[model samples]
Target: MPPLFKHPNFVHFWIGQIASSFAFQMLSVGIGWQMYDLTNSPMALGLVGLCQFLPQLLLTLVVGHVADRYNRRLICVCTRFTMAMTVGILAYGNITDSISANMIYLCAALLGTARAFEMPANQAILPNLIPNELLSRAVSAIASAREISVIAGPALGGLIYLIGPTTLYLSSMSCFLVSCVIMFFLHYNFTVKTKSPISMEHLFGGLRFIRGNKVILGSVSLDMFAVLLGGATALLPIVAKDILHTEAWGLGLLRCSPAVGALLMSIYLARRPLTHSVGKIMFAAVAVFGVATILFGLSENLILSMIALVLLGSSDMISVVIRSTLVQLETPDDMRGRVSAANSVFIGSSNQLGEFESGVTAAWFGVVPAIIVGGVGTIAVVGLWMYLFPNLLKRDTLEQ
Candidate 1:
């Protein structure tokens, strides 16, 4: 068996992840493209992200407890099943030409709720699927899987969009079916160490743990702030249409560029995991991410912009692998759900809230200035975080 595929459970789990993530990425491409196409308003695009993120902010602890106390494979099955139904409705609406913007917002909210519950269990389940020794490589393997989805999803979504919105939605619904089937076959007995009463602390323990652990606190917060400011994915539709002078096809290639870089980097990291000065490397990677974002914002030329995105994806993947390793390895098996839930909030804000910010900012200032300023803010956040979380910055090695 290969290093990442050493365990059968891990193999099944990864297969499920592939389908789930593929559906998600394709859904994202469809939503962003469709919303922008409908309203021609950047704010509408931002609202899509906001509706998706708000559910996690409200139900973080509740979902965390569910992950801890429940059968996670079952949770994965149930959520994706709902997602399939929801997207199926979208497909029907598109075919009927009756899917209103309000309906899209409502659908996005449902999808977000499902994702909020799904992420904690999904993240927490990984430790049970593989041994501690293989964790670093496993994390890389996971990134590779996600990057593959990111690479293929947009490219495919954009191509399929040429056929019609119904085609795109139907494709996503099918991917969700595959995810559900794989989850059913995944066999892993999750051992929950928590035998305590359901108290407020038990519910919120993950947040407390992260609060005290400067490393987790610093790393998660850093990601939250950096990407919260630096992410340009939300503005890409605008860039592709208004600035790059490209249509849906060009948008697909642009979206794929970063993941292309990430997929290549993940293959390298899987074979030769980072072993020393891990903290320093992570910070440097974020800085690189910030610079790449800036370069992308300024470039009007398609080739230069694509190269910048590749750098952005590569650097961000390094940061992701390091943070995931640090957070997961440091937590006890039982607290993984809560901690991962807390981590998911950070991720949701980085991605979803960041999208909102991009739209709002673009509405206030032009898209070009909004993107450039956000990239600068990302760089600033890194410096500030480096100062605040010195332990994370000075820390070395992925193996605790």
Candidate 2:
């Protein structure tokens, strides 16, 4: 067995992460495809991302505090259970022929709330499970596992969707429920007894820490801007239906192409983790991501598009690993939850908010133009960030 997997707590946590991540990916495919199908409007699809992000924006102040002071594992379990129920509600609505776009929006908001709590707690839990020596590998393992789900979830969701939306929802619900059960068995040795009362200062401590740390700030903000500008995943449904003239299964393949690249890169990193020139590597990866996005935007052929997506995903995995490991290693354990929550804000902005941006741009400029412009913008951000944050640009190693 791999030395990392020998840690039982980490093993259980890893399993739960896979289950929940798989569920979320399937849910995303279902929601994106369904919303686009119903409204045939780019704006409605954008609103789905908006709904999910609003909760994260609202909860950022409180989520990290809760994760630090409370039981992170319990928080994970509760969030998974909440997601199970929320998806079940979605399934019920579908079965009853009462599922509206608005209903999906509401469910999305609820799921986002659950995710807001789950992410920080889940991230904070990692350092507690394994030794410091294993931290990078742990992060790599989890990212790789997530890529596996990313690879499978959409494809499976697309296939099962042929069976029906209701069936897909039910399948996602089952995965969340299973995650809840798996997390219940995860045990780690830690006790939280709020040392300080909640105050405005305490709530924003993570942000303060990030602000003082230029490396963390630069790394995270770079990712935020690059992804915010470059994110094309949100427009796959449009590309599949209108541009590519493909069906649900084709959309699934389109969605998973990046993950296929990410999965292969993640596995390689797991075996030979980045030990030097980490910062430059990360910036280069983001640059590649930008280029790949542009390639994807310009390509009309499905195979060419998939190839572009694969390169995009591979580049993204490098950034994800370097950024994640740097954040976790830099923050003290007591501060990890809040710091992770703050990190989540950046991540959420890049992903969910990026979707909104993509939708708005697509609506105004047309889908193809929106993607191309975003790709160019991403490349611009990389060049600008390199000039702006030289400390980040000069960073040579992941080790602090």
Measured by lDDT, the strongest candidate is 2
70-181: candidate 1 lDDT, tens digit per residue: 8888988999998999999899889889988998999999998998899998988888888887888888998999989877777788888889889899999999999999
Cα lDDT of all candidates, in order?
A: 0.89, 0.89
Model 1: CA > 4 A from native: 29-46, 91-103, 158-168, 192-194, 237-251, 298-300, 356-373
Model 2, 86: alpha-carbon shift in Å? 2.4
Q: What is the lDDT, from 0 to 100, of the residue 284 in candidate 2?
A: 95
In the order shown, the candidates' Cα RMSDs to the true structure are 3.0, 3.0
Worst 10 residues of 1 by lDDT: 188-197
Q: Give the range where candidate 2 is weakest over 10 consecutive residues by summed lDDT.
A: 185-194
Model 1 local distance difference test score:
0.89
Clashes of each: 0, 0
